[model samples]
Target: MLLQKFKIKSMSLLTFNLLLAIWLAAVLNVPFYERMQSLTPHTGIKSSLFIAASVGVLVAAYTFLFQILNWKWTAKPIAIALVFIGGFASYAVSSLGVLITPDQIQNLMQTDISEAKDTWSWHLVVWTLGMTVLPIIAILMVKFKPEPILRQIVKKGIASVVSIAIVCSLLFVFYVDFAAIFRGNRDLKGMISPQNMIASFISYYKKKAPKENLPLVTYGTDAHRVINTSKPTQPKLMVLVVGETARAESFSLNGYTKNTNPELSKQNVISFAQVSSCGTATAVSVPCMFSGMPRKDYDERLASHREGLLDIAQRAGYKVTWIDNNSGCKGTCDRVHKFEIPAPLKQKWCDAEGECKDEVLVDSLKSYLASIPAEDKTPQLIVLHQMGSHGPAYYKRSTEQFQPFKPMCSTNAIQGCSRDELLNSYDNSIVYTDHVLNQVIQTIKDVPNYQTGFWYLSDHGESTGESGMYLHGAPYAIAPIQQTHVPMIMWFSPAWQQHNATEVSCLQQQKQALRSQDNLFPTLLSMLEIKTQVIDDKNDMLKQCATNPDGKA
Candidate 1:
C-alpha cells in the first residue's frame, strides 16, 4: 500500500531518465559540490554563477548517458547499477578521500578477504543503505508507459542530442571557471561520483583482463652464481625485507621526530634518505620493482608474463623463497618457492581475522631455516614481506607491548578519530615494524657459516590526513610526496661485507643520493653476484662502492 502511493502510472522513458539524472546530480553529487565550494572561495555573484553552471553541466552529462542507453529492457538495469556505485563512491570520497582511479580499482580487485574486512564499519552500513537502498526502491517502483519500438528509438535519439547541446553550451559559457578547477587538479575528475567509478572500472578491466594465451618471457637465461671464494665456505644468504606502507618521513632513521627505529639505530645499517617508490600501491609497485622495468616504462600486463628478480635469482642457483604475512606475493613468487604462515605459527602470532603481526614473518623464517638440511646449503635469497602499517586498521598492526605511543585510535573508522590518535597508532605500528626488522637482523646473525646480508625497502608510503587524503594508491603523476617517498635500509654481516669487498663507509656517504625501487633489481643481482646480460651496472647503487677484489667484477 505504501509503494502504491509513490508509483508512477504513466511516464515516458525520457522523463524517467531525466528524473534519474536530476537525482544523481542533486543528491549523489554532494561530495563533488563540497569539493568545488572548497576550491572556489565565495565571491558573491561569481561563486553563485559557477555553482549553478557546474550543476547544469553535471545534469546534462548524466542525461546524455541515460538517453543513449534508453532501451526498454536495459535502461532500468543501468540506472540501478549506477545509483549503487554513486552512493558508495560518494561515501568513499567524503569519508576516506580516496579517488576512484584505475590504479585504485586494481588495488581493490587484488585486496585479500581479510584486508577487505578491515574496512567494514557500522557507519558504512547505515550510510550505504540510506543512500543506495532507498533510491533503488524508488527506481524499482517506477512504471514507464508502453510505447512502439520505432517511436521510442526516435524520441530517445532526440533527447540525447538535446542533452549534448545543453552540456556543450553550459561548459562553453563557464570556460574560465571549469578550466581553473580542472587544469591544476586533474584528480578532481575522480571526484565526480558514478562517472569516475564507471570509467575507472572499465579502464582497469580493459587493460588487466587476460587475453589469448601467451608464452612467458624469461630473462637472464645465462645467469650463473659467481661465488666469492674469499667469503665463508658455507654459502651466501641474503634476506630482502619488503615493508608495507612505510613512509620515510615517519622513520627516525630518515630524520623523523619520533624514535621509531630504536633497535635499528643500535645496529650498523645505512638508511637511504631519498628513496621514491615505483607506484603508490603495492599491486603496481611490487611487480614493477621486481620486473627490472623502470617506473616510467612499466606495464603491469607485460610485467606479469615476464621474469622478475626472484625468477632470475632461482635460475642462477640461489634457493629463492618468498614468505608473506600481508597479501599473497601478487604472482611475484609463481616460479619460485613460496611460504605462508602455518597453523602453528598463526596460533602464536595471528589475530581472529587471520591477520598476523609481522613478528610471524620472523618466526616463520626462523623455523624454515632450522628445517633445512645441514649439508644442503645452496645460496639462499629469502624475501620477508611484512604487513607493516597497513591501514585504516593501524592499531591492529602492533601488539600491546609494541605500541609505545598512547591514546591511539583503535577503530577501523580512522578518519573519525583525532589526528593525534591516528598518528600515534600509525607510529606505533612503525615501532612494531622496527622490532620485526631487528628480529630479522638477529635471526640472520645467528645462522652459522653462511654469509648473510639484509635489505629493507617499503613497497609504498601512506597519506595521513594530508590535503584531505587518507591511505594510498593515488595516481602516480598526481600523488603527494607522502604516497611516493618510501623508506629503505640495508645491513650486512661483517664477514659478508668483507668477503664481497662492499665498502660500508662508501654506502653511508651516498645515502642521501636520489634512488628508487628501480635500483633494487640490478643492485640485488649484483649482491647475489649473478652474472647475466640483464644486470645493468648503471642502475646498481652498490656498483660504485664495490672494491672489486682481484679485479673480477
Candidate 2:
C-alpha cells in the first residue's frame, strides 16, 4: 500500500512543474533574448559558445531550485505560484519589450484596476492560460513521487547543492564572456522573468521597510501669500491642472499639424513649447514635480518624507484643495484638502462604463467651490488631476461628440491597429482634452470674484507607437522625445494678471525656452507671490519674462 501511495507523490512530476516555469519564463522573453544576442561582443564560434554557456548557467541554476522545491512540504503550491509569476511577467515583457525593474514593480503597485484594465486583451488572456493557468491545472493533476520525508529532504538538499556548485563552476569557466554580454545590457538582468519579479519584490520590500519610518520634514513654515499692499490687488484663485499622458508633439499650440488644441489655442493661454517631464511614469513625475528637488537630484523616499510645494502653499494661507480625476495625485496632495472620484464607477465625470470625462472635473469643482463659505475670501489653490489620454484605450477618454477622427483605434492594444488609426485615436483624445480645458477655464471665469488663473501641465508624455513604442515609463535618460516632451499651458484672466502685475505677453515670449518639471515648484510659488528662502530663483522659468518692462510694484 505504501509503494502504491508513492505513485501519487511522483518526484518526477514535482521537478517537471518547476522546470516548466523556468522554460516558460525563458521562452516567452523573446525580446530580451534577442537584444542580448545582438549586444554580444563577438561573432561566430565565440558568440555561439558564449550564448550556450549563458543559457546553460541559467537553466542549471533554475534546475537547482527545482531540487530544493522537491523536498518542501508545500512544494506543489509554491511551484504553481512561481509558474503564475513567470507567466504574468512574460505578458508584461512581451507587451513592453522592457525589463521588469524594481521601479516598474513600484509603478505597478500604484496602478489602479482601471489602468490595469486597459492592459488586458484576448491575446493576453489566451497566452496567460496557455502559459500559466493550464500548466497549474496540469501540475495539480499530475501524480507525485513519495519517499520517506526525512530521507527525501536530505537527498534533495545534497543534490541541490551539487547542482548549484556545477552551475557555478560552469559560470566561472565562461565568466569573461558572460560578464561582457550582461554588462553591455544591464537591463537584461531583470528580463529573466520569475527571478526578475522575485528580485523586484525583494527590492521594493527592502526600500520601503526602513524608509516608511522617516518623518515628514516641514518647509516654509513662514509661508504667507505675498499681497502687494502698494498695488492693492484682490486675492488670487489659481487652478493647477496635472494632466496625464499628454505629449507635447500632439498639441496644436506646440505646432503639431493636427488641430488637437483648437479650443485651447483660442484662449489667452501661454503654451510652453519646450517643456519636458521629470519622469516617464506618473509614479515618478507627479511626486518629483511637487518636490523642491530637480529630477537629477530627487530621491523618491526622501521627497515623500519631506514637505513639498503644495504643503508650503497650504502653510502660506491658501485654501488649497486637491480634486483628483486621475490616479490619486501620486501622493503629491496627500496632506492638503483632497477629494478623489471613485474610479471605474459612474461619477458625473464618468461615462461609457466607468471612464471619467474631463467635464466631470470642471462640474465637480463648480459645485465644490460654491459650497466654500462666502465669508472666507482667502486665496484658493485648486488642483485638478485629469485622466488625459491614458492609453491603449484612447477611444474611451473622449465622448462621442469629441470623436472627430473616424474609426479610431477602439481596441486597447495599439500594436494591433494601423499607425494612422492609432494617431487618429490619440488625436481625438487630445481634442477632448482641449474641450475639457476650455470648460475648466470657463468655470474659473464664471466664479466672478477673485483674480482667477489656471496652469496646465502633464505629469508625463506618452509614446503613441513612435518607433514601435507604445505607452509610457521608459527610463527618463533613454526615453524617446515623445515620452518626455509634455504639453504645458497657463491661462490667467486679463483682470487677474492685471491685478497681480503679471505680463501675459512677456510670459508668452518665453514659450520657446527650454523648461521642465523643475520649474513647477518655484514658478507656482512665484505665481502666488509667495517668497521664502526655500524658493530657488535658478529653477524659476517665469521670473525672467514674467515682469512688466516698467518694473512696477
Candidate 3:
C-alpha cells in the first residue's frame, strides 16, 4: 500500500514539474542553450535537445518542491519577481559580463537617477507586477486546487526530500561544469563574477597606487605628469568620438549590406574593417581601450600603472574636455573638464516620460567649445561619448526621422520580433550617429587658428539575434563576431592634413594594419606631436605610419 501511494504521489509531482518547466522555458528563454548552439556548428539540434531536457529537469524539480512544501501561494509572487528581476539582472550582469552586486547597483543608481527611475517603471514594477498578477488572476478564476494524490504524497516527506536533493545536485554539477569551461579566459572570468570583472575600476582615488592605476602610460619618465609638448607650426584640435554599443558588422564602410555609414563614406573617412575590440562589453572594453595593457594582462595591478588618454592629453599641454551621454564608470576622465548632465530633464530634449535623445550631448559640447578662448595656443582634445544604440529599447535610441530601414523596432520583449527588426532599430541608431558625427566634424572645422582631426571608435559592439543572443557582454572567449568586431573611422580635414601630411599619410597607409586599444595611446601621442621618453614607438599607429609610409598589403 505504501509503495502504491508513493507511485501515485510521484505521478502528481511529475505533472506539476512539467507545468513549471514550461513556464520557466517561456520566461528565461534559455539563453545558454542558444549560446551553445551558436558555438557548435553542426550540433545545434543535439545541443538544443540537451538544453531543453536539462531545463525540463530543473523545472520539474522546482515544481516538485512547491508541491511537497504546500507553499503554492508563494510560487506566484516568487515566479513574478524572478521574471522581472531576471530581465534587468540579466542586462546588468551581462553589461558588466559578470555577476550582479549591490554596490554596482548603487553605482548605477547614483550615476543616473532617471535611468534608475526608468528601470523601476519599465522593467521592475510594471513587468514584474504584470507577470505576477496576470497569471495569479487566471489561476484564481480557474479555481485551481491541488490534487488529493498530491496532498497525500506531500504528507509522506521522504520521497519529496529525495527528489529535492537530486535536483539540487544536478544544478550544482551543471554550474560547476559551466564555470570550469570559462576559467582560462579572463574575459570569461569577468562574465562569471561581477566583483572580479574589469580590474580597471578604481572606486577611490589612490595617489600611491601602481603604474596601471591610470588607463594609459605617460610619455615622461616621471610617470605621473605629461611630457613637454614638441613645438608644431599649426594649432591642433583632436576630437575623439567614443561610441556606445556599435558593432563592425553593421557599418557599410566595413562592407555591410546596408548603407549605414553613407555620410562617413562620402567624407573620405578611413574605415578599418578588420579591427577587433579588446573586450566584449563597454565596461571592459572602455577601460581596456584606454589602458596600455593588452586584454590578456589587464588587471588591477596594470590598471594602477596606466593613466587614461584624457590625462595623457592634458599632461601634453592640451586642454582636455569630456562630454558624455553614457555612464561615467571607471572615472576615465575624472581629472579633465567633465560635464555630466543631471537626470529628470526639464527640456523638450528630455520628454515628460524622461526619455532624452543622445543629440543633446552635442548642445553641451557646443557650450563647452564656446567657453574656450579662440586665441589659446595649447592643443585641445575633446571627447564626445555618445549614448549610441544602447538597447532592449532600441526604438528609443533614435527617432523615426533617422529610421533608414523599414519594419524595424522591437516594441515588446515577449512579442516575437525578427532579426530584421532588431537590425532596423540598430541601423537607425547608426544613422543618427552619422548625423551627430558630421555635426561635430563641422563644428571642429569651423574653429579658427586650429586644424581639426576626428577619430571615432566604439567602446564595444552588440549582438542582435545572433545565436539567439540579442545583446552583448558575453564572455570574450565565447563572444561572437558581432560583439568583438567594431567600427573604427578617422577624418582629417585639409588644413590638418597639410600641417601633418606625413603623419596623416602614414595613418592612412597603416589604417588596415591589425590594431586594438593597445595602440590608441601611442597613436594619439603621435598625432599631438608629443614625444615622450616612455612611449612605445613600435605599437604607435602614427609612428608605424611614419616608418612604413606604404602599409604592407
Candidate 4:
C-alpha cells in the first residue's frame, strides 16, 4: 500500500537520464565542491561562475555516459551501482581525507582480512547508508517510458554529441583557470567522486594483468660471502624488522617532545634522524626497498619479477627467514623460509579477533633460534615484519601499560575525534613498537656463538588529522612529510661490532645524514659481507663509516 501511494510518475527515458545525472553531479559531489571551494582563489561571483561551469560539465559528461547504457535492461542496475560507488567514495574522501589513486587501490586489493577489519566502524555504515538510501529508493520506484530500439540509439547519439560540445565550450571559456588548477593541484582530479575510484581501479587492473605472464628475472646470481681472516670466526646473525606506518616525527630519539621511544632510547641503538621512504604505503615500499631500486626509477612489475636482497643473501650461504606478524612480505620473501604465526600460537598472544601483538614475533624468533642445528653454523638473515603503528585503530595497537598517552581515539572513525586524542593513540602505538624493537635487540644479544645485530626501518609514515589528512597513501608527488619521513634505527651486539670492526662512533656522527630506502639493499649486502657486482658501494650507507679490522678504511 505504501509503495502504491508513493510511486513516482512515469517519465521519458531521456528526461530520466538527464535528471539522474544532475542529481549525481549536484548531490553526490558535495566533497568535490567543498574541496574546490577551499582551493579556489576567487570569491563571490567568480567562484560561483566557476562552480556552475564545473557542475554543467559534470552533468553533461554523466549524461553522455548514461545515455550509452540507457537500455531497458541495464539502466536501473548501472544507475544503482553509480549511486552506491559514489556514496562510499565520497565518504572516504571527505572523512578520511584520502585520494583513491591507483596505488591506494592496489593497497586495498592486496590488504588481508585482519587488516581490513581495522577500517570497520558504525560511522562508515551510517554515512554510506544515509547517502545511498533516498537515491536507491527513488531509483526503484521511478518508471521509465520506453521507446523502440532504433529511436533510442539515435536519441542517445545526439545527447552524447551535445555533451561533448558543452564540455568543450566550458573548457574553452575557462581554459586559463582550469589549466592552472589542474597543473597546480594534480590531486583535484583524484578528489572527484566515483570518477577517481573508477579510473584508479581500471588503471590498477590493466597494469596488474599483463605482469602475471612475465618471466622471472634474477640479479646477483654470482653472489658469495667474502671471508676476512682478521675478523672473528663466529657466524653472523641479523634481525631486519620491517615496521609498518611508523613516522619519524613521533619518535623521541628523532627530537619529538613525547617519550615514545623510552626503551629504544635506553638501548645502544643508533637512530638515523633523516631517512625518507621509497613510497607512502607498504605495498609499494616493501618491494622497492628490497628490490634495490630507487623510488624515482621504481617499477612494481620490474621489482615483482626480479631477484632481491633476500635471494642474494640466501645464495651467499645465509639462512634467510621471514617471520611475519603483519601482512605477508609483499612477495619479497617468496623463495625464503616464510613463517606466518600459526593458529596454535594465537591462543597465547592473540585477541578474540585474531589480532596478535608484535611480541609474537619475538617469541617466534626465540623458538627458531633455539631450533638452529648446533653443528651447522651458517650466517642468518631473519626479517621480522611488524604491524607497527598502523592506523586509525591505533588504540588497539598498544597494550594498556604501554598506552601512557591517555584519552585515545578508540573508534576507527578517527576524524570525529579531537587531534589530541588521535595523537595520543598514535604515539602510544609507537611506544609499544619501541618496546618490541628493544625486545628483539635483547633476544639477539643472548644468541651464543653468533655475531648478532638488529635493524628497524618503517615502510612509511602516517597523517593524524594534519592538514585534514588522516591516514597514509597519498600520491607520492603530493604526499606530505608525515607520510614520507620514516624512522630507521640499528643496533649491533659488542661481539658483532668488534668482529666486523664497525666504527660505532663514526656511525653516530653520521646520524643526521640524509638517507632513504634505496640504501637498504646495499647496506644489507655490506653488513652480511655478501660480495656481488650488484652491490653499489656508493649506496651502501655503512661502507663509508666502517674500517677494516686492520684499521684501514
Query: Which predicted model would earn the best TM-score?
Result: 4
lDDT of 2: 0.78
TM-scores of the models, in the given order?
0.93, 0.87, 0.70, 0.94
lDDT of 1 by residue, 287-404 (tens): 9899988998888888888888999999999999999998877778888988766899999888787888899999999998997788887889999998999999999989999888
lDDT of 4 by residue, 1-553 (tens): 6766788998778888998898778777877787776777889999989888888889999999888876778888888888888888877788999998888888888888888999988898888678887788888887778689888888888989999999999989988878888888989878787888899989998884236666779899989999877844788899999999999999999999999999989998989888999999999999999997878988888888899999999999999999988878888999999865666677888999778998898898988888898887899999999988988899989999899998899988898899899999999999999999999999999999898989899999999988888799999999999999999999999987886654455556667888889989998888888889998776777676644232112
User: Candidate 3 residues 168-210, lDDT tens each?
Assistant: 6655655544444445433422222212222323332232133
Off-target runs (Cα >4 Å) in candidate 1 are 1-12, 38-42, 145-162, 228-234, 545-553
- Residue 536's lDDT within candidate 4 is 78
Candidate 2 RMSD to the real structure = 4.3
Tens digit of lDDT per residue, candidate 2, span 210-322?
25567788887777776767877677899999999999999999899988888888888888888999988888899999988898898888887788999999888888899
lDDT of candidate 4 vs native?
0.87
After superposition, candidate 4 runs with Cα above 4 Å error: 1-6, 148-158, 340-344, 545-553
In model 1, the Cα lDDT at residue 196 comes to: 84
Question: What RMSD does model 4 have?
Answer: 2.9
TM-score, predicted candidate 4 vs. hidden true structure: 0.94
Output the lDDT of residue 278, model 1. 99
Q: Which 10 residues in a row give candidate 3 its minimum summed lDDT? A: 189-198
Write down the lDDT that model 3 would get. 0.62
